[model samples]
Target: MDPKETYSPLNCPKPVAEGIWIFDGLMIRMDLGPFKIPFPTRMTVVRLGDGTLWIHSPIAPDEDLFSAVDALGSVRHVIAPNSIHYWYMADWLERYPGARSYAVPDLATTAKRPFRIDHPLMDGARFAWESEIDWILVPGTKVSEAVFHVPSARTVILVDLIENFEAAKLSSPLMRFMLKLVGGLDPNGMAPLDLRMTFRPKRKQVRERLQRVVDWQPEKVIMAHGRIYDRDGAQELRRAFRWAI
Candidate 1:
């Protein structure tokens, strides 16, 4: 019933890089085969060169949260980086009608509700962020995720590709164990066991894509569902994908 138990001090925007911030929001449970798992929600906002926001995996929004976000800049581009993470896109667009939406193409069929995608999350589209942000699609999953590298900030933003749930944040040993069973335990987190399996058939493609990310030499890595890897990011990226790479 309490979101703070999963992600505390909610509805606040915390800075990640000079032009980037992360907002923590509601708690949610996702079904992983037969198990229902609890996870805290996080979203990233990048103030592009035009001063409009580039949101990735938007969290549930409240008026207050919207106002705080508006102060950062006009909400211009809302993104559903992957299929499963598109849940709250509708809530966001309803408030910022001027904001254009973009999502993974696979979402057209996977989404339970109709999601408006103004563009595909593709690179070389001449997006405003091109000078600062480079992107690529991490293939080999039903819920294809788009990963972004902000060279100016040395940050890489991700949704669902990795989950590093900190042990101290969980209230129960059982919950921690269950989370670990899904490969979400901190310091060793990668995508959940089930998600990684999806890459088995295309591990080479996944590995090649991940290696390109590792070469970015990121200094900070941000995740939507767990702790942020704030240092040694490129190394962390390599370690997390070690199993398949």
Candidate 2:
């Protein structure tokens, strides 16, 4: 999927899954405004096999995006996986008042300021989403508390663990320097330079967490920061965080 075509001039197209669909975002460069970014952000819409839709991550502030999401099946839940991502949850929840909000425990309390969070994610816990998506908690990230595994695509959806960027065009000195330092412009960007030190103490935990991830033997890794890994997923994950290997 070419970023420019898939999400460029327009917002991410709706992706229909086993009852789920994805409404990606407008790519925004730090220098370029939201509409002018050379890249885009993708939001996930998980419709459980039961027809209950779970909206993950935040959506753009545009009215069209909001209207599009409303057109989907009944939204039973809204998730702000981590602390830093709840900014858009308020609008979404307001629009769909019937949908209950859930967040990581730490974020749940704080997220209350904007939305009514009804559930807190627990580590090692498993939740039966749709027949197609089985979610598990990956408790080491500072913001997000879990990652999702989609067995059908041999895909593991990680909100902040690994990110695959198209380095060719994003290789500009500014982008490179920034990515090499603060990490990417989004949550799943490769380990930020700051997180490297923070994650040092949790190295073993992170490794063990990944071990469980490997148990899934995922083929595609979907990260929120950059592009998705379609092949050699395991090796690419190891390379994403050098310490994990």
Candidate 3:
């Protein structure tokens, strides 16, 4: 067994949009039911103008996953947005020997693998090259923090903090209903129906983060699960945690 191989089935479906291709499934979530997600996974590939490439949220391990990445040209960096999203990084690092992997602030200590997390993202951190991608650390609710927004593409990528399962291709009725019950249909698709209420005391802080997101005026919003939000993303997010925002 490859010590770095944390994934079971390996590989996931391939979905491409704009200049990014999403690779889904990299872990096994037995709790998700007969969903056969192989692993609930999603990955993003961005090709910048200078010919450098960036892939975010590497999911599960599979022979095919690496081959798929190899097909996309040389990958320069792999970003593990949060601790929960680091499961497959070891395998990805092993596969792309020369590629650099970066971990969000709180994830590196527990990652258990050796790699330099070249970038550390704090709340409201903005990175700009020819295009601009902002990382807003939404703290307090969960121990996790997400790197949000890619201005050049008008896209927002949230890890566990916000999920949109619409990309999961759920054929099971139970899965769909479960998703709806948890507000998965919403733009942010926050976990626990009561997440807003869980952090009721910090509602003010949450609202401040939301306000910053609203200021960005993103055109496209993508979560780990559910459908992508194309229009009125700010309002959708506000409505998701109505109590908090």
Best by lDDT: 1
lDDT of 1 by residue, 14-66 (tens): 99888999998888877756665678899999998878888888998898899
Worst 10 residues of 2 by lDDT: 30-39
Query: Best by TM-score, which number?
Result: 1
Go through the candidates in order and give each one's C-alpha lDDT. 0.84, 0.61, 0.61
Residue-wise lDDT of candidate 3 within 1-245, one digit each (tens)?
A: 22122222335434444666566554355354445432255677776666666778876656777777777778887888766667677778878878876667776565666556666666444443325456666655445556567677777676655655552355556766776776554334655454434445666776777667767776666555445566666665555545455
Better-scoring candidate (TM-score), 1 or 3: 1
Count of steric clashes across candidates, in order? 0, 5, 11
Per-model TM values vs. the true structure: 0.94, 0.76, 0.73
Error of 1 at 73 (Å): 0.6
| Model 2 Cα lDDT, one tens digit per residue, 1-245 | 34532344454444533444566676654332222324445667765667777777765658787667667667787877765557677887888888887777777555545667776667654455646766665445455446677776666666656544555546355665555455544323465554455556667776777677777777666665566666666656655656564
